[model samples]
Target: MNFFKNIIDKFAGKPVDWDELEEALIRSDIGVPMTLRILKTLRERDAWSWVTANDIAEVARDEIGRVLPINPPPIRPLPAHPKVILIVGVNGTGKTTSAAKLAHFFKTRRHTVLLAAADTFRAAAIEQLGVWAERIGVEMIRGQYNADPAALCYEAYEAADKHNVAFLICDTAGRLHTKSNLMGELAKVKRSLSKHDPNAPHEILLVVDATTGSNALAQAKQFHEAIGLTGLIVTKLDGSGKGGVVVAIQDELGIPTRFVGTGEKLENFAEFDGRDFVRNML
Candidate 1:
């Protein structure tokens, strides 16, 4: 998303355009409250000095850092034979794609990774994940179309032990958070994982598209409420989503982003860094 660019050229060293700056921040998806807070911080930081756009950028960077702490939350460590990461998200949020990227991320580091195509509600989803597993050179455990997802996950968890895979990432079906039945089934999937290993689903990462704006935030709330989310994997950053929903998620739900997808290529993904994100945002 194009945010906070070329606005600096609008001001020199004289009086700052407070109105324009406010508008820019709002457009950036910083929201009204955060925009006001950033403006207030700019004034207080250097009340008398000539406020430059850089000064405003500095305040924004610092404020973002405060809300999204530089220290990321600790996901469960590996070496459990089948360390499972339950991937969840809504439809069209690139949930399936992110799962493959995650497997690629881990496998590159020499960790034996396997994927579970637990999204059995759709034959297309199952086939899509299967294709990704093959392209990435990883084993995939998938169930029949319209099969019970929870039972499939249980089987995948058990198979991981025999395969001696270091990580077992389960790709769950994409469901709108507003749908109660689908959400409940997701809970069942999580429970099924625990039946094999009490702490089986070591990480439940929610994948969201950056372009969904506040809709992404809404999805995060309900999914998190249904099944406690360990972290987030924000995708489609190369699109129009300014990625401010990430900030909103952190500020409101306290869920930190673990990774971001900058493009469609497998190498487009990277581990999230608070400082780096803030710097580029402003």
Candidate 2:
């Protein structure tokens, strides 16, 4: 973090070394295309050889600001049926925790919310989400371990609709993005929900670790391609300062980060704000 400060510290009062600057930008996890763009912009300046680190940081910030949406539309409820939100991610990305926090977020807004513990691949996942549900005072629908997640989600949707819930958050099983078999299972979940309403899963949010840096972009790409991600829920952002994937994902894949998880507590989560993110990038 302190992205700009790092740049200034390394090259201040010294002629900017192009190779070093390129490495720094790339190392920040902003992606190769963004790094090249920043370099190109600096090289186009009148005094290219005399460019300072401050100038580099300023241009990098400007470019990132342009790429990120200033205000991504907030997640809202469907007028008639439950607004389904499918949460997906690979292992150790805090997928289940984010689902609970998201449910808490909607509940605090006075919206009736329901939780679906569809991560039946692991017994502990079900128990974990169940604990969060009890702590948050929300109803959860869960299935037996080693159950079919797609079928479980379909049943959850039916219950949510019957209860007239405003939101139905499904915490899905974590799997590697590269596994076609696992990706196909997610597609099945989408198909199952679509049976109720053409757009039942209104939001397919991918939970990514901010600390994962550029690898997060690859996850986004694969998941977006498989099930069509509507947005992202970036996790573990507190004190990591490695939030560059938020910019890179948007810049490369055009996927806006909808929310961010900064800590373990539910209160640590918040909707992503482009202006605040850009300001903090410095």
- lDDT top scorer: 2
Clashing pairs in 2: none
TM-score against native, each model: 0.90, 0.97
Every candidate's lDDT:
0.84, 0.91
**Per-residue lDDT for 1-282 in model 2, tens only?**
465567768888888788888898888888899889989999888263578777877888889988999899999998889999999999999999999999999999999999999999965999999999999999999999999998999999999999999999999999999999999999999999999999868999999998999889999999999999999999988777588888889989999999999999989999999999888888
After superposition, candidate 1 runs with Cα above 4 Å error: 6-20, 31-33, 45-50, 71-77, 239-241
lDDT for model 1, on a 0 to 1 scale? 0.84
- Which portions of model 2 show Cα errors greater than 4 Å? 46-49
